[model samples]
Target chain A: MTMKKRNLLLSIIAVIVLFGVANFVQLEMDAYIRRIVNLCMIYAIIGLSMNITNGFVGQFALGQAGFMAVGAYVVGIFTVPVAMRPGVFYATPMNPAIINIYMPLGVALIVGGLLAALIAFVIGTPVLRLRGDYLAIATLGFSEIIRIVITNASSITNGALGIKNIPPLNDVRIIFLATLITFILITLLINSSYGRAFKAIREDEIAAEAMGIDLFYHKNLAFMISAFFAGIGGGLYGALLGTVDPKNFLFTLTYNFLLIIVLGGMGSITGSMLGAVIVTAGLEYLRVFDEPLELFGMAIPLFRPGFRMVMFSVLLMFCVLFWRKGIMGTEEFTWDKFVNFCKHPLAYFTKKGAHAE
Target chain B: MEFFQAFANMTAASFAQHMANGISLGSLYAMIAIGYTMVYGILLMINFAHGDIVMMACYFAFFGITVFHIPWFMTFIGTIIATALLGVVIERAAYRPLRDAPKNSVLISAIGASFLLENLANYLFSGRPMRFPDIPLLSQNIAVGGGVQIQAICFVIPVITIISLVVLLHIVNHTKTGMAMRAVSKDYEIARVMGINIDNVISITFAIGSAMAAIGAIMWGIRYPGITPMLGVMPGLKCFVAAVVGGIGNIKGAVLGGFILGLGEILIVAFFPQLSGYRDAFAFIVLILILYYKPTGLLGETTTEKV
Candidate 1:
């Protein structure tokens, strides 16, 4: 009921949640789980980054996958063993060049973001004027183009063999700590004046333009912000997977983010977070199709494959028809919202009284 | 004289090749673009899942032929029915309720539907690519000029495309259902007041468009002969670009746009392989250029905002 009590309760809850996550994360068995966590953190970063454009700024961009690929390739080329780069791009560095070039992960991530920003800058000037569906399609095309170029630049990208053996940032601690720091920075940024400006554009771009928000500057910034995080996410993914393929950034992969953004609630930070978890976990959990099955009396063989995707699609259809507003319906989970949620979990998840935006 | 001869030969070959490629690709683009334009005309949502639907249609056709061992003609008929039914069902289940929702909500739902389809297909059919069976009927070649070869399928394709276009034109211009579609696209509330069943028009639009996608899928399977759950991804986006480039809500514009995009792709491939890597880039660039120059598209009229 009171602000102080609510703040105290929230702090206690945050500590407990963090503690639980730490304990839970330790339960994973293989190196891949740590990598997946790193990947998810990167996704959270990129999803948050995309939130600036699609979520906060209200521009529908399908280019995040492309941007992430760019970032991944950038980090991959720079950090991969020259011996591994196939010696096609340049004469094998006299020494293993990536080692001497290692920057702090913070700096590298920023560099990745900046590079994405630069790419976004070039693409945005000509493309941002398109509205709604047109804008979305254009961005989608741009991502595909990015993938195409990377795939074709064989001398540089190794012509689809992809850049492999990039130095791994194997510490879960780094990822966990970095993810925490990123969550803080993005949350702060979204609550600041700039975030409000983004929301202004989202609510009504025409009105925002009338309000002198300088649509070009704000949008490019949002795109760059999104691209930057995507780049960082890519760097982490590359580090985790140790192999970077142009195909990895396919439009199909982008669909997952689109699904997450949609399922979470477009234009909502909390929604993006909730979405990333459900989707990433859903991809793995859908392995029931990969497992042995028995329907009725007959022994259905294992890995009837593609079964999960069918179920996923069914779930998606159900969500759209029955839960169109998605999990949060653009509602943010502040302390007050959370307290109310704790009191009425059903209403919170069910989005009771929530209507279409 | 030598320079003139050389220049003339290259220009002729490139231009002819570009034209050939454009017409072929254009016909396919036109097939899917029509679906986009039709849906946008009535629903105002971009049907994000249409690409996957095109893909699903191919698989459906595959199932009809390879799995059912049906005759090719029967496969064609069955696929049309199945895809048309799917179109109507998707509209009713996913989009019908959101008819009046915000544009963004519909867009997301369309995306959900798309994922649902692609993932479903990946589950039912493996992610591994399937070979598209060749049609014995259209398996031949034709020659247009000195030293230039063209597939016989090319000529048959245009004929089928034109016939379909003529039929669609008749349906849109001469039929009563067409009138209801036009009325709904122009204004939903007013159409409801005028006793038009908006749901029926929407379903018809989706069914017709999806049927066209099925035909396109069959043709694409013939030409490329490979099927993947994700196959529709690029074509869907490119065709949407064609629809937008021509005119989002204009049927004729979508057809024309399809040709231009098809030609554009050919020219890019012919002239610049370095840029070939960025082949898909052209669609977005054209979309941006059009949005900047004429957001209403070539044949599209400017939409009026509701007060």
Candidate 2:
């Protein structure tokens, strides 16, 4: 058999095995484990989308939370049962226009993604002109503005009270499927000619412009795509949590995805996937920092409610300072590379050593 | 028609009161913006932790007055010194290593520093809002003519802002150290060739910027009357927008930008009370509009990108 066909077969088998394992975990695992797994998949999607703009397109836009807010709100409004609107919209009556329109989960999620992409398209037109830190601050501003608007638009968004009891899509199978589809789509795009254009822009904007690449169009395209996936992830997030609020989409929430990208290796899809799993599970594991601990028969005073975040922030600083390339460093996992590494571990180490030198 | 009629019927006393409030608020913004502009001018990067530094200064003063029983004046001076030292420390620890690294790496480090400082404060201080000890001279309400009432600190804030501006302007424009600073900002290698200590110049800039943040924080505490760990976030962002609007590298422009933002925020609520819920959105909207129309900002010089 050809190497290409064999690799494809191997990948398909690997995916099937993963799905089988997921089914087993769903049937056997407790609620907490299931929830964490779902979060990992959702965050993986978020990390990948973030990579599209921040990693590939070279724009340091920090508006993921805003896009996620759009997605979550859309999903919350549409997927919630018609009977629950009054209870959810307790402060202000449900807007008459959207009161009766209930959508299935699949349709609602897609609509949410589209709505977020539409918002990105409008905002990106003017904003993508900015370079570097200006772009970052502008995107951050838009995200904050989105949060404030959501807080005030009580009639439509149900304001600060938020929508509750969103029909949970907590099934492992559903999340795995959604994540797989998102992963494949993004990977396909990244390997295409458009992806090359994105990398070119990242390498040098001036040179890219000098060459025949349309900076505005390509940037807007990548931004809208990123927003779309972030929206999907947001929809999944709301469904998993079964609640949606303006507070849930604060600017700090974007920092979670930022940490994931930084830790996983920016510009690498497999890196994002690995980062999502580690970060999500690691955060859960790090809960010990927030709980009282006894060391050497004495209670440590530093272990408290807010200490986990302090450790997390310190880790992020060290990562940026020393390990800026992170785990993957723009390199991806491939069948051939895996095979080569397995065949000669010494060669792999030596190759890496040579590159470092 | 009703809105116009009410506007027309508005008393001069209330108008003057709002004006005073705007100026006082604007002066605070100017102080903070000066820090942002100065740092950006020298380093070509935003000091994301400048706001958090302001937050730390507030905490310093809080501990100084409440815990240590220091007098307000002494605390204020000590806070200034502490904040300046903190700025120098941040520059040396967080920023100095990445001086020649990629711009984005330095930015990420700055963000990391900001998060570290904020989270550290949250861990140490317990995230509770504390009442700022009111200074008798600053907190007392003074009535100006026609029943216009304003805080004495409101007047004091503008005077401080103006005096600081003049002093900063003189130091940047006239002194030997200022000459070295301008040289380093113009070209680091060239300044080093001319025997200027690049590190010292950068450290001095941070010291001045952080001192401004300390002053701004104190004024912010007096005006708002309550202090929290997160208090710096909003003003920090708003003053950043102010710096950008006034032309980031231009010292005088930062003051202008600050007044515009402060007065505009007050007038926005004054004109449309219903829109008060969207108050924080105003600064961002202004930033977007300014960046769109004139990316160099009002007083910023346009520089071309070299391939």
Candidate 3:
């Protein structure tokens, strides 16, 4: 077979095996492990969505949390059973228009994504015109504005109390499928002409404009698509957590994705997915550092309630300081490279070290 | 009718009190904003850790007064010095190494530094809200006139803010170090070519900015008296907004922007109490509007992008 055909065949077989394993884990594993798996997929989707804008487009927009809020609220509003709406919005009645409105999880997810995209389209017009730090701050401002609006609009969002009793989405199969589809679609886009334009814009705005690429259109397109996926991811998150609140979508939440992208290597698709798994799992694993520990009946005072976060922050700083390129550094995981590395791991390190030297 | 009714109910004393509150708060904002403006002027990068430096300063003051049993005035001075040193160390450790790195990398590093500072505070301070040591001299309520009770710090803050601003301006415009700073801000390469020490200027900038933050934090702690690990986040963001509003690289602009934000925040709530719930959104709305109308800021000079 040609290299392309062989790669395609391998991909299909790998995907099938992955699904089989996921199915086994979902069915047999306890709820705790299963929740982690679901979260990994949801976070993967969110990370990939962020990578589209921050990585691929090279726009440092800090509005993912805002867009995710829009999506989460939509899903929370629509996916809750009609019977539970009164209880959820007991503080103030749900807006009569959307009060009895209920949609299946799948439809609600799409609707949420579309609504977020529409909002992104509106917001991107003015916001995307900004450059660098200005854009980042503007997007961040918009995110806060979104949160504030959610807090005040009690009839719609149930105000600061937040919507609860969201139908729990524990099934790993659907979430996994959604994540797979998102990855494939984003990968395809990144390979297309539009994606090339985005890359060109990221590389140099003036040069790209000189090359006849429309900067505004392309940037906004990437932003809208990013918002769409972030919305879907947000919907999935609400489904998984069975809760949605304005506090949950604070701008600080954006930093989580920022960490993922930076650690995974910005602009790398598979890297983001890998990062999501590592960050989600690693954060949980790092809980050991938060708990008081004993060795031979001696208390270790260093392990405390907030030490885990302190360690996490230090890791981020260390990564930025020494390993700025992160794990993948704009390179994708190709089967050929993987096989080569497997065969001669020492050679890979030696070559890399030599190159650095 | 309600708006009219609210406006009608405002007495001269209440109005004066609000004005005093606005100016005091505005000056406090101006003090913190100067740090952001000065750093942005020198480095062309937002020192995201500046706010955390303020938080750290408050903690330093807290520890100095409570644990060390230091006198309040000495504690304030020590806190400023320590915070200034912390600023210099942060710059040397986190930012200096990334001098030639990509802008994104630098920004990420700055954010990392910020998160590190905040989380470290959380770790050390246990994320609990601590009572800021009361400086009774500052926090005491004084009846000035017409039954309007105002804290003594309100009178002291604006006076101190003006004094510092004048001192800062004098240093920037008249002193040799100030000339060096101006040159560095103008063009790093040209400044280096002119035999100015870039690293030293940057370090000095961070120190001054942080010292200002310490001053602001002291006053802020006295005024509000609630200290927490995340205390700086909102004020940090708002001061950044102020720095931008007045024209980021201009000191006076930051001061003006600070006043605008402070007064706007107070007056909006005073006149439209119903809109008080949307208070935090006020700064962002002003920011977006300013960015849309005058992208360079109110007093900022526009620069053409070179091909």
Indicate the docking level reached by candidate 1. medium
Regions of candidate 2 where Cα sits further than 4 Å from its true position: B1-6, B145-148
Candidate 2 lDDT, tens digit per residue, B69-167?
999999999999999999999999999999888888888898889888988999899898899888888999998888777999999999999999999
What residue pairs are clashing in model 1?
A55-A267, A113-A228, A306-B122, A306-B123, A307-B123, A309-B119, A309-B120, A310-B120, A313-B116
Rank the candidate models, highest TM-score first. Answer: 2, 3, 1
Tens digits of per-residue lDDT for model 3 on B94-145? 9999999988888888888988899999999878899998888898999978
lDDT of 3 by residue, A1-357 (tens): 787887788899989998997899888999989999998899999999999999988999889999999989989999889998888889899889888888999999999999999999999988898888778878888898899999999999999999999989989998999999999999999999998998898899999999999999999999999999999999999889999989999888888888899999989999999989998898888999999999999999999899988888888888888988889989999888877898999999999999998
- The numbered model that scores best in DockQ is 2
TM-score of chain A as modeled in candidate 3: 0.97
After TM-score superposition, the amount by which residue A46's alpha carbon in candidate 1 deviates from its true location, in angstroms, is 2.1
What's each prediction's TM-score? 0.89, 0.98, 0.98
**Candidate 1 positional error at A189, Å:** 1.6
Task: List fnat per candidate, in order.
Answer: 0.81, 0.78, 0.72
Model 2 per-residue lDDT at B171: 99
Question: Model 1, residue A129: what's the lDDT?
Answer: 73
DockQ of each: 0.59, 0.85, 0.76
The true-versus-predicted C-alpha distance at residue B80 of model 2, in Å, is 0.4
Task: Give the Cα error of residue B254 in candidate 1, in Å.
Answer: 1.1
